[model samples]
Structures are given as structure tokens and as C-alpha cells.
Target chain A: EAGVTQFPSHSVIEKGQTVTLRCDPISGHDNLYWYRRVMGKEIKFLLHFVKESKQDESGMPNNRFLAERTGGTYSTLKVQPAELEDSGVYFCASSQDKQGRGNTIYFGEGSWLTVV
Target chain B: AQSVTQLDSQVPVFEEAPVELRCNYSSSVSVYLFWYVQYPNQGLQLLLKYLSGSTLVKGINGFEAEFNKSQTSFHLRKPSVHISDTAEYFCAVSENPSGTYKYIFGTGTRLKVLA
Candidate 1:
């Protein structure tokens, strides 16, 4: 079984440019989450998806940031007009479900975004 | 609201020496504790978790953490560490209420094992 996979492991864009990061969760996983770690900062939660529906999105930084999970299988986070502060490592994680004992969340090699 | 604090930003120890990384958390409700390790250019991997049962939780790579409810701490320790153990370790907590599974992570501790 493969672990969570992410695309564009590293990306560099100018300020005001747009970027999209993608994540494919493990097979049969129903819970997907997004988090990020800025330079010199702790990893912070961005949002979560339970299947196609968003379970929580309180951590989204601003209106320029948007996340979507289509068909409950994969997710994408888009940053419109990316700013210098948007530079960081974006991580995607998945779990079997919300409950149970063995439901440990697995993470992917994060996408490194650098907005100059 | 839940929060985590990793007391040390970095810890340096000689190879084959014991090491400890301190972590503390605050939560109003029952919570699940976890430790994760991130190698250079790699994703975070589970070290161990404390859902219930014993306070002493052992994890992969010969690491262990003690959960102290009275002190609100889960400090990770290793009797003897190798240079391969150098990595960033994170302490995380999630409220178990209805299994929301939303994690709150600490700043992380970078363990540098010297040869």
C-alpha cells in the first residue's frame, strides 16, 4: 500500500502569481487534512475533509487560499495571488476514518512553496 | 482550544548517550498524544502514541515517552541514541471528543546526535 502522495515537491513563484498543490490520499481513507510549516514556525493545521465534504476549515489563512477534495479521493490547495508570506512546506495527511484505535494519520512528503 | 509546547528548540547529545525532549500540552477535554519524527527532506513519521493504558508508551526506533497527566506532559526519551537519530521531533495532541482527530502540534525539537 502506498502512503500519501503529493505533487510538485518544490515550487517557486513570484508574488501575485497563483499556485496549486495536490495530494492523493491512501486507498480507502475517508479523512484528509492539510497543514503547513512556515520558516521558524510550528506546523499549523489548514483544513480537513471527510470524504467530499469539508469537516473543518477554520485554519484557512485567508480568502486567497482555497482547498477542494473531489470525489473524496484527492485534494488540492490553491493559493491565488500568492504572497511572500505564503512560502512554506505544505503537508497532506490521511487516516482510515475519524474513529477506532488503529486510525493513525499518515503524511506525505510536503510540497515546498517559495513565493519571491 | 488545545495547544502544545516543545520546551527545547534543539538538543545536542553524543552518540550512545541518553537524550530527552520535553513536551507539554493544555486541553480542557480528554486528548490523545502522539510523537512524530521528520528526517531530512522527508515527511513526518509516527514515533508512538498514547491513547490509553500505560503511561509509558514505547515507539519505533527505541524511543519512549511518558505521559504525565498531573504535569500535562509527554516527554520523549531514548537510552542510547545513534547519529541516525538526528531529526526533528514533534509532539502533537488531539481532542478525543467524538474523534474529531484534529491535531495541535508543538514547535518541534531538533535532535542533533554527535559522533
Candidate 2:
């Protein structure tokens, strides 16, 4: 089975520009998550999707960032008017319905966003 | 709330030498620990995990981690590491108490293996 796949491995855009990163999780995965890692910082959670429903979006940075999972198959994270701080590696992961130790979440190669 | 701390931002070791990466976590509730490795321009891959079995959990690529409850640590170890082991290692904790998928990750330790 293929692992999680992401498009546009690297993206460079001017400040205030918008960019949308796409993620396709493994087949039959119900839990999809988004995380970001800024330079010199830990990988922070952004949001999660259990199928088409948003489970926990408390980690979302601000209104400029939006994430959507349509048909519970793939997800897209769009950053509108992205700021310089938004530049980082965006990772998409997915796992089965299980949680904790038994749950194994597979990550994508990550989409590196560079906003200058 | 839980958080992970990796004191070593980077660790340098000669190939075939033993290496250890320290990971400390702070959480009010019980949690599950995990170690992940990421190669250059690659995604995170599970190295090993500590669920509820033995304190010493072995993982892929000849990696192992010991979960010390009292110390609140899960330090990764390799008896003899190879040059391919050079990569960024992250220590993560899953919210077991809440039964959620949210994982608290550390800043990561970049292991540089010398020839």
C-alpha cells in the first residue's frame, strides 16, 4: 500500500500571497491530520479530520489558514495572505480508527512552504 | 496539556559508535511515547513506540528506547549506529488519557554521524 502522498513538495511565494497544499492519505484511513514545523521549532499540530468532520481545530494558527477534507479521501490546506511566519514544512498524516500505541500514523514527504 | 523537550539540538557521533538521544516529557496524565526518524527531504517514519509492554521497547533500524516513568523520559539508543542513521529524530507523545490522536512532539535532535 502506498503511504501518504503530498503534492508540490516545495513552494515559494511572496508574502501576502496564497498557497494551497494538497494531501492524499492512505486508503481506508479515517483519521487525517495536518502539522507544521517552523524553522527552529517543533512540529505543531494544525488540525485533524475524521472523515469529513473536523475533529479538533484548536491548533489552527489563525483565520488566514483553512483546511478542508472533501469526501473523506483527500485534504487541502490553504493559506490566504500568508505571512512570513507561515513559511515552514507542512506535513500531512493519516491512520486507522485506532488510537494510542496500536495506531500507526503515516506521514507524507511534506510540503515546504517558503513565504518571502 | 503535554509537551516534549529534546535538550540536544544536534548530536555528533562517529560511525559504529553508540549514541543516545534524550527525550523528556511533561504530562499530567498517562501517555504513550514514540520515536520517529526523518531523512533528508523525507517524512517522519516510526522508529519505535512505547505502549504498555516492557519498559525497553525496540524499534526499526536497530533503534531502541527505554521508557522511564520516574524520569518522564524515553531516550533513544543505538548500540552501534551506521552512517545512514544520520537524520533528524523526534520524540513524540500520544494523548492516551484522552484517547485522542493529538501528539505532542519535541523540537527534534539532528544526529550527525561521522565517518
Candidate 3:
């Protein structure tokens, strides 16, 4: 099966500009997640969606960041007026099962964003 | 709340030598442990996980991790390392796998395999 895939593998934008990263998860996977990792930092959870609805987004850094899962097949993470701190690697992942005890999550290659 | 700690920021080992990366966690409730690896220009991939059942879990690429509940630790180990094994490894933990939950990740340890 094809794993999670992300677009615009690398992007560089000026500060205060906007950028949107997209992710297409593995087919039939309902649990889609977004995570980010600043340079030299651990990969941190950003949000999660179960189909079309967001299950939890507590990990979201701030209001400037918005995530949408239209039709629940894919997801997009937009950063408005991006800041330098926003420059990092954004990872998208998906899990086939959420009700089970041990579900494996597959990840994308990640979209590297550099805000100057 | 849950937190993970990876004491070593980087580890260097010769190819074909044994290697171990340590991971520790703290949580009020029971936790599910995981190890993920990222090769150059690649996304994070699952190395191994510890939920229930046996304390020792083996994963892809001949990687293994032992979960010690008492120590609150899950350390990744390999009998022999390859040059391709060089990458960044992350340790993460979730308070509960079922229902709504988020994972807490460590600072990560970069393994550098020498030839």
C-alpha cells in the first residue's frame, strides 16, 4: 500500500507571508495527524483528525495555524503571517485503526518550511 | 500529562558493533512507548513499539527495544549496526493509546555509524 504523502517537500518564504502544507494519507485510513519538528528538536504532535472532523488539536502552537481535513481524505496546514520559529519540518501521519490497543502510524517524507 | 527524555543527543558507533539508545518516560497513567527513525530526506518511520504482551519487541531493520515498566524505560538495541543505520531516532510516549490522546516526544538521538 502507498504510504502517507506530502507535497512541496521544501519551501522557503519571507516572514509575515503565508504558507500551506498538504498531506494525502494512505487510502482508507481514517486517523490523520499532523506533527512538526523545529530544527534539532523532537517531533511534536500538532493535531489529529478522524475522518472529516477534528478529534483533537491541543498540540497546535497558536491561532495563526489552521488545519483542515476536507472530506477527510487529505489535510492541509496553513500558517498565516509565518514567523521564523515556524520554520521546521512538518510531518503527516495516518493510522488505520483507532479503537485498537496497538495501532501503527505511517508518516510522510515531511514538508520542510523555512521562514526567513 | 506525559513526557519523554532521551539523555543522549548523539551516539557514534562503528559498523557491525552493538548499539543502544536510551529512552525514559514520565506519566501519571500507563503509557504506550514507541521509537521512530528518520533517515536523511525521509519521513519518520516506526522502529518498534511497546504496548502490552512481551517486554521485548522486535521491529523492522533488525531493531529491537525492551520495555521495562519498573524503570519506565524503553531502549532500542541492535546487535550489529550498518552504515545505513545512521539517522535520527526519536522516543515518544502516550498516556493511553485508546480514545483521545497525544504523544510526547523526546529531544531525539542522532546515531552516527562509522565505517
Query: Which candidate leads the pack in lDDT?
Result: 1
Residue runs of model 3 more than 4 Å from their true location after superposition: A98-101
- lDDT, each prediction: 0.94, 0.93, 0.91
Q: DockQ ranking from best to worst?
A: 2, 3, 1
Query: What is the lDDT, from 0 to 100, of the residue B16 in candidate 2?
Result: 97
iRMSD per prediction, in order:
1.3, 0.9, 1.4
Q: After superposition, how far is residue B31 of candidate 3 from its true place, in Å?
A: 1.4
For model 2, what TM-score is found for chain B?
A: 0.97
* Off by more than 4 A, model 2: A99-101
Candidate 3 lDDT tens digits, A19-98 = 99999999999999999999988889999999989999988999999999999899999999899999999999988865
Write one digit per residue (lDDT tens) for candidate 1, span A1-116: 99999999999999999999999999999999999999878999999999999999989999999999989999999999899999999999999874565447899999999999
Which DockQ value does candidate 1 get?
0.76
Q: In model 3, what lDDT does residue B58 have?
A: 99
Tell me the tens digit of each residue's lDDT in model 2 across A3-84: 9999889999999899999999999999999999999899998998999899999899999999999899999999999899
All candidates: DockQ: 0.76, 0.83, 0.78
- List TM-score per model, in order: 0.98, 0.98, 0.96
